[model samples]
Target: MSMDPVETFRIEAAELLEQVEQGLLDLTHRLTDKDLVDAVFRGLHTLKGSGAMFGFDDLAAFTHHCETAFDRVRKGEVPATVELVSAVLSARDHMRSLVEDEVTQTHRDAGAGLLADLRRAVESAQGKSSAPAPVDPAPVAATQDAPAPAAQAGWKLWFSLPANAMTNGSNPLALLAELGELGEMHVEADTSSVPPLDGLKPADLYVAWTVTLRTDQPRSAIDDVFIFVMDDMQLRIESLSAETEPRAPAEEIVAEAPSIAASADAPAAPSSIAPRAAAEPVAGSGDAKHGKSSESVRVPAERLDELMDRVGELVIAQSRLSQLASASTDLQLRSVSEEIERLSGELRDTMMVLRMVPVATLFGRFRRLVHDLARETGKAIELVTEGESTEVDKTVIERLADPLVHLVRNSIDHGLELPADREAAGKPRTGQIRLSARQAGGEVIINITDDGRGIDRERVRAKAVASGLLEADQQVGDHELLQFIFHPGFSTAQKVTNLSGRGVGMDVVKRTIESLRGTIDLTSTPGKGSEISLRIPLTVAIIDGLLVRVGDGRYVIPLAAVEECLELSLEDDLRSRGRSFISLRDKLVPFLRLRELFRTGTKPDPHQKIVVISTGSERVGLVVDQIIGDHQTVIKSMSKLHAAVNTFSGATILGDGTVALILDVGHLVAAGQQQEAQLRAAG
Candidate 1:
């Protein structure tokens, strides 16, 4: 299906807004960075032009104001101030609403307010930079040996856009009008490239243009007119008055062209002018200019999800075929099954790589968030990110965004000390929050670390006791006590604030991470800092799982979490009946019997097996009746009836068409750890 052009514009506009916002945020650190200034200008300029082309009039008009503001900064008319950047940032958000939603009265009101603030910021910046504004230099003609002046110059230009430009929502007339605004100009259409009527495609643009323009604006301003279409078009600009010879007759130049449609203000032509070499493709506007056109295609995310679903179904069918071939004695059938299995496996791996996106895409948004949060909280915060290049499943990144936002907000609002308090505590005034990600086996570990006042264990304990989450004066480990912060309606703050402290976010964060079959670990020092580590599976769709049998039911353990398997003898099982612990390398690892846990009401197999699974540093053993070898598990979500059941994360179909529950490794490990803690406490 063809995508809606308006939707395409919205996507592109969203990306441009992100660039503009990032540029504005970076300007806070170095107000006079010329490169960043140019970048912000280009982003706003492109967004305005594209928005106009796609018929987003409001977006175009609003973004134009921002573009003009940055354009002044680029030309040194005004300095880049924090207030100016902040105003543009707010304007950038309103521009998003214009692109995304129907223009409502509320939106118009908000845009007006933002623009008013933007004007005030510009005035404030101008007041700070008292230098007299530079006067426009006279357009000067030069000989071949001397360089052209930086001021405006007379120019002759010829250009044609890509053939499909009009079909892709570009308006040649609008472009011409914009060029007309530059200064006095005469435009003539060159129809020599037009094909015969019998072979012509109406959607294709075959006409080119030749123009003679006299403008005080710099050459870059002229270039900006075609910024959106420069990549695939041909353009040549020449200094019309560079020659030392006398001027040519106007009639002679007009007669040289087969078809001439001149503007009303056409002036006498100069002597024969040689065109400057074709302009190199303008660069540094955005990622599109970085030669990605030939290397990548923009695909809808839902299409990828559909493709994944198809691949998963194929995997299940392949598994069934493999099982059938293994049972049969036909060697040819078995060979074909093995070949198909290999091919499907390779295809699955390729599909997964296609779906993996860098965490940088996820990390990039936080820069803006931190900027806004720092301003809101009146705190000095420096956000440091590492492992941005680390790749994770796209779906994981999408769902992980909200949870990470909550965690980072909590870190700033609850964990970090105020600037005054931090200094009083003999620490640096600026607190740091670091976001880092790395792949550990088949899991991605994301850590949010903050160098600020850590969580107050005593406060958490007091809250827990008052909320009845703990008995008063009860003994509890620090880790256990800190976990009370995640309980529903739990808060240590004395009063509610706009950012947090209403007792709402942390519980949602915990539930969200758990819903992804992920585990969160928290550690902190009283005065130093705190870090929260989230261990999440690399992918949620399909996994290499160890299928095992417990009583009459089968379960699949994620192969990534399965460290090793060991046989549990009848003698050892009988001896460890009450404690449910096994000795491995001189350490006791807690074990859970699936039969007992599920209440299968069946006797155990004489020689059962223990599949040792782990999440982060915690390990647990699942005692099963049989180890049924490896299987490719295409995870299917459990029904709503089973939504509250945390033991199994999902279910999968076996070769025999039986449904096998996929164990939630994170939940089981936490359970085992809790059991171990309880036993230790009882002793």
Candidate 2:
């Protein structure tokens, strides 16, 4: 389905806004960087022009002020300052609201206030720098062998819009009017491309234009006039000197009329002329690359999701066909099933790749968050990101964003100390928060670490004890004690503040991670730092699972978590019956008996299997009646009635149509670890 043009503009505007914010944030570090200044200006310019083309007059008008401010910075009329960047950053947020929602009184008032601040920032910057604004240089002489000079005093431009321009709601006359705003101009339309009445397409654009302008603005300003249409339109710009006549054939030189000369103060009124000779190519002109096609297409996320669902359904049907083929006597049926299985597998992999997106998209937003946090807390802080190129399921990225935000905010608010305190502790005045991610097996490990005062064990214990979560003088490991921070309404803060100390965020983070079938591990050192690692699966839609039979019921274990399978002989099983521990390579590993856990009265098979699974450093063994080979499992969410069941993450249908439960590896590992601790305490 074709997307609404207005919706498409919204997406493009969002990306432009992000670019503007990133550039402004970068300027906060290097205020004198000219390249950054130019980038900021270009982003703002393109956004304003595109907004106008899309009929967002309010946005276009509001953004024009910001574009002009940056233009001054680009021209050395004003210097880049933290104050200026902050004002623009705040305004960039308002631009997002303008794009997303309709304008209201509140929005108008907010925009006015932001523009007022922007004006003050520009004025303040002007006062700080007493240097005179740089003067525009004289137009450079053009050479036959050299590129067109950008510092031209006058320009002659010829351009034609794309055939679909009219259909896509573009206005060539409005573009001409904007060019007239640059300076004194003369425009002549060439109707040579227009076909006969029967051959003409009303919705298509066929008219080409020739425009000559005398202005102090550089060639870049002309390019900005067509920024939105540059990728698909034919455009040629040639520099001209004031004294030189236009390089045109005698037949092309029609009578020059005074009324056709568009003044900077007036709207453009272009005239139509007779057919002229084909435009001559200028040296170093990018005319050859006009109407270039893009290599990639933008696809909506919902469409991708719908396609994934179809692929998943196909996989299930293929599995059923394979099952029937295995029991069939006909060789052709079996062969067809095998081919379908292979093709379905390939399609599933391809669909999975389409749904994967880089973690960089998730990490980029935090730079702005950290910048704001530093100002809010009055503390010097730096954020370092690593492994941003790691790719994960798009759904996982979306769900993980809020949890990461809560974690980062808590790190800044609770983990880091003020500059004076840090200096007194013989540490750097500026605290650092490092966020990194890497893939391990089928899981992505995202770690958020902060270099500052670590979690205070004493305070955590006090809070836990006071909240009745622990007894007085109860002994607990550092890892276990730190987890108390994630308990509901638990806090070590002396008083509540805006960022943290309310104790509402961490528990939600824990719940959200658990809902995604992921686990969180917290580690800290005294007076050093703290690190929180969240291990989440690469995708939740489907997985390769080991189909195993426990008693009369069958279950699926995630293949990523399976280490190795060992035979549980009747001798070893009876000897270790009560202990529920298995000996592996001379080391003891805790094991869970599914029959007993599910309270199934059916006896185990004579030959049983112990499937070894591990999550991070913890490992556990599951004793099952039979190992039923591997299956491609499509994960289906559990109903609210089974939400309390921690042993199984979800359920899936088998080839024969029976439902099988998918094991929750993280939950089982924690259970095994708890059992190990209990056994040790009892001994």
My TM-score estimates for the predictions, one after another, are: 0.90, 0.89
Clashes per model (N, Cα, C within 3 A) = 0, 0
Query: RMSD in angstroms, all models?
Result: 5.6, 6.0
RMSD of 2: 6.0
lDDT of 1: 0.82
Model 1 Cα lDDT, one tens digit per residue, 1-683: 88988898888888988888888888899998988998898899888888888888888898888988887888777888999999998998899889889999899899999999999999999999878754322222122222355532566777666566676667888888999999999998867666699989888777777888887565556677876666556555555544443353332222111112322133333333212211111111122323445487799999999999999999999989998999999999999999999999999999999999999999999999999999999999999999999999998999899999988988998889999999999999999999999998888999999988898888888888899989996888777788788889999998889878789978898888887878888999889999999988788898889999999999999898899999998988999977889999999999998889999999999999999998766799999999999988999999999888989999999987889999988888888888888887777
Candidate 1: how many backbone clashes? Answer: 0
Which sections of candidate 1 miss by over 4 Å?
134-153, 243-294
Q: How much lDDT does each candidate structure score? A: 0.82, 0.83
Predicted structure 1, TM vs. truth: 0.90
Worst 10 residues of 2 by lDDT: 277-286
How does candidate 2 score on lDDT?
A: 0.83
